[model samples]
Target chain A: MNDQTLFSIFFSAMVVNNFTLALFLGLCPFMGVSARVETALRMGLANIFVLTLTSLAAWFLNTYVLENAPYLRIISFIIVVASLVQIVEMVVKKIAPVLFRQLGIFLPLMTTNCAIFGLAIFQTNRGYDFMQGIVFAIGAGLGLTLALVLMASIRETSELSDIPAIAKGTGLTLIIAGSLSLAFMGFAGLL
Target chain B: MRTTTPAEDFVRGIWKENPVLIQMLGLCPALAVTNTLKNALAMSAATFFVLTCSSVLISSVKSLIPKEVRISSYILVIATFVTLADMLLQAYAPVQHKELGAFIALIVVNCMILGRQEAFSSRNTVYRSLLDAIGVGIGFTIALVMMGGFREILGIGTLFDIPLFGPNFEPWVVMVLPAGGFLMLGFIILGLGVFEQRKKSREAAAA
Candidate 1:
């Protein structure tokens, strides 16, 4: 396990193994919430914060508490992520109202984002230690952020293109995403 | 809000409120599992089983659960059923299970299942919830099979491993890949949109 270098994991997770484009982790928000660039950026940041905490807590529990009963991993990990998101939501609301209004509205939905859940599940399956798990989470979060921001930028411009009437909303976004997914495939050789 | 008929609840999920094509929920498995017909069918069956079983179970127990912990309870129920389905597939059909890999467990995070439990099962009667679950399950399965058929036919010139096209036909490799999944889904949405609009305009002109 240690043979795989940290830089490789970070780079692969961030680009070659993106959660949305490459792995199809969080397509709902990748499509639904990516209407504007600012909102997408906020959602990405919020996901990074929550995902880091989730990876930390999930790794701790998996290593120490639920070491024997691997079957209970999913139920326990979900509770951990959900509760963490709730805490982050409230804390963000009280400490920074402006930030809250910008990103807080998207926190609750992040619970079911699948990318966060996928992060914990992947790190667990990969058997990453503490420091390694955090690094992987950061990479995954940044990967998600990059995908979201890029999709938002394209969709924002999509409005200007003289798109066919039938392919106005999601149809057009998906076609563009397909192209992006193809482009991301070029990073496959980097590893 | 207008009260819906029991039959309406059962029927709407297939198309009008279809989870994948219309609402855009559960896109992960839709794209990942549709490369081949068998995997698509297996994934769809597992999802349908979990969604329908959990919907009924959650609905029946909805009253006993407190509001504060309802969401957690829902997760527990959904995860338990997903595990059961995963185990069943692994034991009986190891090949499909291997093909599905982590996506089976990832079903726990699918917004459609959780969304249905929160939006429908948590409030409705068990029978009604069951109807809604079956409807959505069938709808999701139909979408999977549709996309899988499209990809399989184009990618390999075969459906369900049976040769449909002769040696002259050259398969488009991209259709079997992840990129093709997105493009196929996009074109389907576009076709549906165009069909719906044309029908609307025709009716308007006649009226």
Candidate 2:
């Protein structure tokens, strides 16, 4: 049982290797869903909820089931995460309909979003215990949210500018993201 | 039911409305894994297997999927095939398996596969869906191979590790890096735009 170190984990999640800008784990939503700032925030928050819970769930399952039954871990984890996504979608719809509407298709899409699953596998890779996994999830979720919100705001502004027709939507977005990735590389050796 | 001929179904994936370059689906794996000809071929084959199987299964079971819970159903179907691919890669091709790593499992979430199953397969017949999958799969493979060829030759000065360049050649290290992936994709998109423009002019002249 490795004792959780808060500083290192936070650093690792935030700077040492950011999920979106650095690792490129979840670029689909970063590009597809970032058309509006409001939608981006909602997606970011949804990610936070799912990422946090997935981490806790994955950690518990890994400790109890996967450690003993290594063969079953991958299948079991997906099953658990899949059902949990359904439940979360339901709970959000019932309790927070407005936010749910804001999230729309992205809510269920989170179930398969590589970032959440990546978090699960990464936590396992880093050998974080339950508590550490939760913290890592929260940090990673916040980082994802931050990047999403920032990109959305910038993109909103970018759309208003007179840009070339071909490089308007995805083309410019990819270039901007590439530059953002280069910027994120600055933090590589910090950890 | 208007039966879509099998030949048309298969041909669509080859050019008309190709998934990777034209539709711009599944760029993550297309760019990330295509560093060498061997890797691109391996990734393409794996994708083809998973795609063909999922299309067949999803189309066959499309009617059973409830409208309200269709996405979940689609994901489950996709995930099962992704697992099968993951295990196959692990068992048969350990090196490719290690290189593809999380990306293989991430295939379950690949918008291309899921997008097709939801968009094309769910509504279409089995034969048409099979064609759509194959078309998209081929399109994806072609894009990967092209990107892999450029990156391999320029980045390492070698095509499939055969050392195409002489000793004096200095490989552009960036071509193999993540930045290079984006750069190559950017130029590819630009080239397509140019081709589209030329084709439009030629059509105008014909008219």
Candidate 3:
């Protein structure tokens, strides 16, 4: 259990192996929701909540239920994620309609966000205990939020600049993302 | 509603409406597993199989699925085929399977597969859906190959491990790294945009 301390795991997942900039997980939303900082923050925060919850659920599910049937991993993980998002959406709508209105569309989409799915598969692969898995999830979430907010701010600023026609929409975004990723690579030896 | 010809529907995904480069459907594999030509081809083959088969299956049974549970059912269908593809790869091409790892399973979450199911497969006939999937799948494969080609040639100084640039070439290590994927894809998209614009302007000038 003490093979890797909690702080190192957190730092590695959050900074060293960032879900978006480094691993390229959840890139669809990273590129899509990042156009506006407000929506990006909302989406990032929502993902943190969803990813943390899913990680916990997935840890238990893998430990107890799906350990025996390795083949069902894909279907089970996706179904669990989908159902969890649905549950979270309903609960949010009933309890906090404001949050739901802000987050409703992104919730269902999280079902397909590779980060959540990747988080599930990754934790199991790493064989992290419950506590470690939670830390990792939180770290990944924070990393995702960090990447999204940064990209959103940059895109917001880029809108004011005169960009060439060839690299306008997606092209410009990719180049910026690539540059951001390269910058984040500086955290390689932090841990 | 305007109906496009079947040939156009099939050809569009190859270039005009490429799922990877144009519509940007599934960018994960476009960046993740495309470091090598072999892995890229395997990934494309897996996606092609899953997309085409799932589209046919979903379209054939679209009427039976209630609207309320369509997404869940579509996911279920996609996951099953992804697993089948995963197993087939593991059995036959173990090296690629190991290399691909979570990505093969990640295919279930590929927006392209699910997008086709939700947008085209569920609405169109089975034949049309199959053709559309094949088109998009080919486009995805081609784009991935191009990305892989550039990465392998520059990043590793080889294409599919064939000595392309010879012994004197110094491979650009960044090209195979994650950052390189983004940079290469960005430039490719830009190049495609430039090509399209020039073609359109040339046509207008001739006219």
Candidate 4:
């Protein structure tokens, strides 16, 4: 792929084809941690960190491991990612309690987020090099953050709206998400 | 023991604490695979097999598992069954194997299976855990199938690849897309809310 095309891949992945909104990756955290705006933002940042680091590590591992040892790639990749999440959790808890508290349990939730794993697999599938993989992860993580923050903002305002009793809480949220997804469809060809 | 039965354990999973509709766990699979009845049924069966096997194995050795490493143990156990399900699907139903992709691999992290182990199985007897597994598995399947049926009928004017609507009828393509899954879930949750409220009021009047 041309170097210029790499930048476009990164751009489209982040804004035009957001992982959470456009591709529906990482719906769990998008829905779960979005109950509060502050938590959403913190989770978004934490996700950026973990996702970028893991994508870089995963890219390097993919190149060396899969090229030479295809059989053990999946299992080894998962173990590496899991351990990396654990290490980040410990580091954040010790170094930044404020950030940790805001993220709370969600820090660990990153291990099973699926978006991270999917990113790794997607990068492998697309055959991105190390630099391209990092850019893609940054874009995807930003996309996830954007979706979470927007959903939280909407939910925050929705708390006071005159929602029918039967459609309060999750029902309403899902509807809003559906509409937002519809809106995001407008960006399908921005690339 | 005052009649603590395994049947009761199993039955509770079907209704009382369903991993999907009630507990609201495993929403990814619930939303992702419920586009068609066939996919839903396949997903449900795969989940049931994995859940049952994981429960049996986890419960049998719950006491033996040290508290510090329980999560890792559960992951290993769940991963084993996920591998089995993945291989079976690949060998027998290659089409579905392609359709499901990484989501099948994602069964290792669905949370429902692990949540059940952490909540009920770890402390219960193997027979009781088996029953609970079946109940929850069936309950999860019901939700997926219902969602899938609605989407297939409305979104594609078909059910399990059979055309139900006349040729003149135009399908709402949105219903077949990912957005459709969210919309269907929203309406289903709303309907359930209305049903629950009505039931509560009726019970109150009777009382």
Worst ten in a row by lDDT for model 4 chain A: A69-78
User: If ranked by TM-score, best first, what sequence of candidates would result?
Assistant: 1, 3, 4, 2
Per-residue lDDT of candidate 4, residues B1-207 (tens digit): 426677788788787777787777878788887788888888888899999999999999999999987876787788778878888998999998888776787776677888899887888888888888889999999899998999999988999899998898799888877788888888988888899999999999999
Going through the candidates in order, their DockQ values are 0.75, 0.42, 0.80, 0.55
Worst 10 residues of 2 chain B by lDDT: B101-110
What shift in Å separates residue A22 of candidate 1 from its native position after superposition?
Answer: 0.9
Candidates 2 and 3 compared: the better one by lDDT is 3
Fnat of all models, as shown: 0.67, 0.22, 0.70, 0.41
Q: Which wins on lDDT, candidate 1 or candidate 2? A: 1
TM-score of chain A of each: 0.95, 0.93, 0.93, 0.93
Candidate 4: stretches off by over 4 Å: A1-4, A66-74, B1-4
lDDT of 3 by residue, A1-191 (tens): 33788899899988788988878889999888898898889888888988999999888898899978989988999999999988878877888787667655566788899999999988887788999999999999999999999999999999999988777899999999989989988999787
- What lDDT is obtained when candidate 4 is compared to the true structure? 0.82
Per-residue alpha-carbon lDDT of model 1 for A9-119, expressed as tens digits? 899899998888878898877887798898899888888888899999988998899889988888888888888988998888898788787664356777777888889
User: Which segments of model 2 are wrong by more than 4 Å?
Assistant: A1-5, B1-4, B61-70, B123-125
- The TM-score of predicted model 1 comes to 0.96
Please, what are the lDDT tens digits per residue for candidate 2 over residues B117-204?
A: 8888999888889888888888888888998999899889999789986999999987787767777777777777778778999999
Listed in order, each prediction's TM-score against the native is 0.96, 0.89, 0.96, 0.93
Error (Å) of candidate 3 at residue B62 is: 1.3
**What are the chain B TM-scores of all models?**
0.98, 0.93, 0.96, 0.96
